[model samples]
Target: MRVSSIYVDGYRRLTSQKINFEDGTTILAGANNSGKTSLIDLLRVVLGGDGNLRAEDLSASARFDWLMSLVDAAIEGEDCFRALLEDENVFEKVPSVVVRIEVGYDPDTDDIRQFADYLMDLDSEKSSFYFEFRFSSKRDGMIAAFSGLYSDIRKAVDDCNWRSANDAEPGSSVFLVLQAKVDAALVNCSKPEVFFSDESYSNVLPMSTDKSFKRLFNFRAVKASRALDDTSDDKSGELNQRLIAVAKEDKNWEGVISKLPSRVVEAIHDLDIRKLTTDETLRSLNTVIESISSTNGAKQNDLFLDFHVTEDHAVQMIARAMQTRYLGAGVPLSEASQGLGYSNLIFLHLEAESFIRSAAQEENRYLVNLVVLEEPESHMHPQMQSAFIKHLLSRVNEIGCLQAAVTTHSSEIVRLSGIEQLRVLKSEEAGCRIVDLRKFHTEEIADKPAETQRLFSFLYAINFSDLLFADRVIMYEGDTERMYFQALIKAHEELAGLRAQYISYIHVGGAYAHIYKPLVVDTLRLKTVIITDLDYEKESNLSSFEKLKPLLSTNATLNEFFQDGKKNSPPSVADLSSAISADTGVALVPDTELAAVAFQMQPEGYARTLEEAILATLLDAPVWTSLTKKKWKTFRNESGLKFSIPREPESPTITQIVASTSNQKTDFMYSLILNSNLVEAVPPYILSALRWLDS
Candidate 1:
């Protein structure tokens, strides 16, 4: 049976969360120290047969924080402890870690047709039965049953004229009687073997046995840091012990030992060690001991190591040191470069696959395997990471009743795998949220798998980790805008707190800025502003401007500012409004609108780009001179056009030169910012947007 979903409550960093598992594979991804490890470890702790929350599992800082919380609760009153017993919230909860696994029934059980009938006729809530288990700090379940007995004992105390103890149910001798009963139950309790079902439920019944549960659930964990000590003596020794156990179970070793060219097995068995242990060997040894004792004038004593065949037929069989030599290099594997790392990682996976396959065989039917891997791409290059993840997935598909969960930060692995396989773990103040991309897709685009693949391909090529964790994001046009914004933010002291808010500035090209609307604004649910330039191939056609006018007019908010008569006479100042789409959290704003708020150089204008807006705001003669001089020295000199520039640096000529440079204005902007000590004023529109984002 496979696990459909896991509901965890009061596990470290996981207050209350339900993480759904997709068939085949599920990847948990997040930033460092963001609780991805904790979530994975907790899953192993729950469904894993011997999983438990021990003190050593927690970090030092977490332990200290937990202690301080308890201190505060104690100072508050007894009500605080009682709240913990109730487990209503994170603070009040004891180790009330409850895990419920929704199990999917196997088809091979009972008759396939009968099972299908049973499933169809079962209750909606009862169809998918939950295997639930919980952890509590104190004995809780049996207390209700024993409370009546305690009350009776308290009343007996009152009748016996023990007035002082009679007033206190707890202080009376009743607790002694309770302890005796508990001890007696522990010593002699035996669970009864019986089955019960409601007569009304003819088609279906819920049943579980310890043997069946054990056979159907298994968990194995391979941590990223585990490869470092794979070749340790203790580990190899354990392998030897396991090998011996296998030999004893099936006598498979006899077949391997029989392959010797000569009679090696016969020669070894011909030692006659059994005959050497007879009474004659003992007498010979005793006579020699007596002769030595007579010569030394001392009494003889019997002290010797004994060798005897035990009742269980066990023999002492020791394995020699493990030696591995590289075939190509003819060198010891440990001495080869990165050989230890590769050997440990590769062999562990091989062993895991072997174990899984063996467990699923006919003789070992009903065994279910859950393999957990942490950073399978560790110490591997990009190509190897891609190959390993692909191979792992393929291998898992070939095995039956096997499920795997991997935690990774490798974007290459993510790209090689499908986007539908990702489960993003985003840490927040409340707790970590696990977002499955399959569940996060918008309803309108749910059926379009090709479009989803296209989007994943585009996002994979770019480094967009910042966007996944940001509170809000501004989507600008290109690198030029991005560079200037980065520099401007450094100089503006009023925008200091903005850095703490985790704001991201992305360079989404003008034509495709709206494509990211569903991802950043819909899936992530972040407030987003699109800063796009008005492009009219030529000022005469006005194709883009005409298209945008109608789209903006469709929104009630935008209609008030840029619809009807206002369209013909477009606002010279910045044009800002909410998007005309159904999503309310996103806004489609023009570069002109932002420029007007940042600088007063424009009234209402068209085709005014970001660079033109910045230049218009920095109208000072020296600032212009510095910018132009840098441009000529860096870019113009390479083009051999520096000699044509006038010494005075006039506005009309300089403006033409600045606008006519290469397509990318990076060299000029980088040189201008470095050469001049002047602080560029934060554009009014940019400042207004930042303020709005903060609010």
Candidate 2:
């Protein structure tokens, strides 16, 4: 789930404003003094936030005063919404600030409809939605004067079907039968994640490790900053060492190392391959912690990787590493840089991913359902910041985490992201005016590579692209898997929704499956359906598949591919060609059967053969151009590069067929034209592959 929209009313600098959220990563943008902070506050409060400020309280009017100071003076002098209160003097000028946020979920996987169904049942099926919000004052002074203001609005939304399509309420229903028109506009905003404001967020829990959860084996990072900041009085480094020492808690490194699948781990990946080069990486972290704890009073300066370890020299480094501006070149712990590193979006991704993964392993993944990041772009290079945002959005599926809303000042960041996910904030005549970027402009920017590729092709490619098919995308690693998936779907219509017709199945090549998988999972911010096999066609290829089998599936083993086939399980291209009577461009090894051939040449051959086979099977050319290289080359230059041509007009004997287009220079027509007999004989797997590619 992702925040689709946010609406603010009667709270901060101005009046009522509603902002829609984007589906993927979003960048919140506004100039300074544009009520950016108030927008943040409104989001925090309305989305199940605990704050001391209440709208009805006279003493709580100071926040409004701040708003007035930023806005007009007449509004501050009058009390329109707060006429009966002590701060009523400024109330007339202060318009009511109501914040509304819309949330979106994967349509295929959304449970909001279920929640809506449950709510509809509660209302005697009269309505699919209801209103519910708590408006208690955060502070005692504000609480004392706070009337039943919260209940009033709840009652209004409950009874009032008066919501315009534009005016979405917090408690909008989902039941189709009751106010279905209005219900369609009402978004499915449910539980979202909350995060600290900054490293200095005293508003909630400090990210410090708690002893209560120690038994859960919290995967604590031994950070360099902690070491740099560790003094005699402050011992985060010592704490980390205690946490990581392995031997201190009636345990030792020896035992821990012994328990690990060291040989297997080494076989899987080299330490050098995974080594952290930058101070920002997690690999160099443990070393920093060790260095910090070893010293009597190592300051932030002593902990920075630049000061201690170089790329070539960091071989001795260990643990989580993050660089802070305060810990830059040299600085003591007490006055050390605190916010610079943790304030970054990169840090958020690392920690949040870590937390989510750990929780998933423990089957408590719901803890990561909501993630709140405040000002993730703080001090980051714009590219790095955008990269961090992309990573975060993509992680939505890896951990099953729900919502992520980040604040940003860079329009470049916003422009780089999808419009569906953005909520632009601005201070208007009222408080903060929120604009759902997806709705704001007919013309919008698509910064993503895939979208850019699509747009480029649309503008210049002379053809439409696959992205035009759906609102969502499902990625595939290669043509074979793509084919298999499509074939399965075609074979069984129940799974047709998983087909490449609507879903974009990118075949980034087999070698890239591992890299492509995470990249797809991360960038799309959605969970992936990885179904691959070590089921190679030949025995020799088994070793090649084994090289990547570890990355393919956790359960993959040597015997896993054995289908107990008494004979050849997967046929080769030659066999497939015979089966379907389809000449799949390339010739297969002599005796290989259909499935093997399909697996090897299915993806490319299908397209190469299918298009030519269907278009026309033969191309006519003069004998001089056809046989002589010099004449043919000249003719090729004059005749345009359109090599796509027809095959033979009719089935010919081998001698006749081979006589034509047998030479390399003359094979264009042969390459273009596919043999129908071959196509007719192509195996089902290869056929499926062809259909998927063409589709």
Candidate 3:
């Protein structure tokens, strides 16, 4: 049996959230304060033998609602308050934090006895059951106590109001006083209870105890704020502790090391310390006790203090002495000498091994094992993180019943893991939402199977997980644009603030930008700006000096952006240019206010590509003369440069010059960035795009 899903309500920020788990591992990823830690805490509290729920565990809204319910009952008559306290139905309506675990099992192959008590379905087709951990009131007398407190609060509030109405100063705020009292009362009255139910939660069977639940599920968590250090005084010998536990369970050490417990006692006895000092000390203590008894006129047997070591004490002493060491260079290095990163990694491995061994033990093995690794990338670098996740998965697969849920903020781990196992926790005003990326793709892009596969393949090849954690994204054309844009952002003061934000710059080019539309706009819902080229081609019959009609563009992304509901025909360049001038060239993605597209525009006469646009913007600048002589001389002289034609035309136009030197765009961009003030030469179209992104 495995836990397939978890439904949480009124727990911290998770007002009502459902998270589905994968068979092997379910990776929970999100920004800080998005409830990843809260979900992990919920799982641990429910399954880790500590079901204690404090007042702060409940959501702010839930707490206020529960408090108001009590106030409303008090405002009514005594009978209403009694009904709210004594009536089962009325009391059950009070708000409480609940977490429901849905377990899935195969009746034909798996042992149903593990969860037989929780089975609520009668049909054979159903293979799942629901078990809930609810934090609520579990005893009587809560009503009378609450009533007296409420009455005192009302009297205090009335006195304060009268004092304020007169000349005297008012006391503390009424709401604050009431809230503190409510929180205190709740902490004293509430407890966590376990229940069995069906799918709809309409039928519930409350378990008298959590013994069955504890026996069925084994949970372990590796928290992020671990007390890990390379110091001898470090109290958190987590790795060493797990090592000892696993070693005690190994049969190979039964007769050899396991006998040390008895040997410890024998070794202490051979020391003869009891005869040397302990006997004398006990005789002195007995004399004092007898003297005190005689003086009090009470007959009592003689008493004395003695010291002896038991097997349990010996075992504890051995455990405390154990330490982990790193072996290399013909010498053993203590954990204090090793890096914390490697130490943390070893700690995680030992934890996984301990969980696996515990489940595989023959004496009283648990039916299912679940491990929660919170921020496993805490101290490791990127490459180590990637390797750790891969190896962690291999270890998980060693046992079929083992399942792991990892919460991380590392893109490297996310990049290495399968998308099907990833769950993104997104926070909203109301609560949090867990988005299954694979399910989203299967549902949203169901019709484009080939495109979907291609998109994902390209994304993985380029580490697309970076975009998953970005607050905003900039998808531009080739490396030349990427380099130039980076330089521009750093050089321009207006756009320099982008350095402080989490912005992912993706080099998707124009041909593939349309493929990532659904993902960036629909799935991730990032604030994205796609900067592409307006690849304009010359007509066949146009004269050398005549204006080239901007009738068509070769860019697939640009074409799609300006499709305007047309099937095969694209908008003419004139219309596109007009839209650009009117600031309507880009369109916001439907239902998302953050996504838009920005492409090249004709700053002077019909600039085709980014190169043409840059040259056009720099045509009238003061640096034009030096730039032309230094960079454009090859095209102007037509002597040694390669082109479509063997002999390049002399005195080439700006368009012809750009076409001839297209292969050297990167070098040209770098030259301009190094030699000239390129920020002033930035095209108006790009400036507009950058301004929109900044906003």
Position 272, candidate 2: lDDT: 46
For model 1, where is the 10-residue window of minimal lDDT? 595-604
Tell me model 3's lDDT, rounded to 2 decimals.
0.71
Estimate TM-scores for all models: 0.63, 0.32, 0.83
- What is the per-residue lDDT of model 2 for residues 55-126, given as tens digits with 9 covering 90 to 100? 332112333343323222212323432333345343343223333333344445544432232121223323
For model 1, residues 341-436, the per-residue Cα lDDT tens digits are 465556555645655655465543444457778878777777777767887888777764677888887666666666667777777666677776
Each model's Cα RMSD: 10.7, 24.6, 5.7
lDDT of 1: 0.50
Question: Against the hidden true structure, what lDDT does model 2 obtain?
Answer: 0.36
lDDT per prediction?
0.50, 0.36, 0.71
Candidate 2, residue 473: Cα displacement in angstroms equals 37
User: Regarding TM-score, does 1 or 2 come out ahead?
Assistant: 1
Which ranking of candidates, highest TM-score first?
Answer: 3, 1, 2
Candidate 3, 1-695: lDDT as tens digits: 77889888888878777888887888999878878898888777788876667778878776666665655555564566567667767554555788888988877877776577678988899999888878876546466556567575446445555322122222346656776787777767777778899998888888878766766787888888876797766667667777877776666755666566667657666987656665776778778878888998998676543566555675578678977777889899776776778888887877777777766666334366788999999889998898889988887876777789899989888888877788898776777777787687566655567976777676655947887677778888878888877888888888966777678888886687767777676777777888877665656444432344356667787676676455466766654555563654454544567777676654533555677677677664211112333355554243232222113554345666677677788777777677445787787777777767877
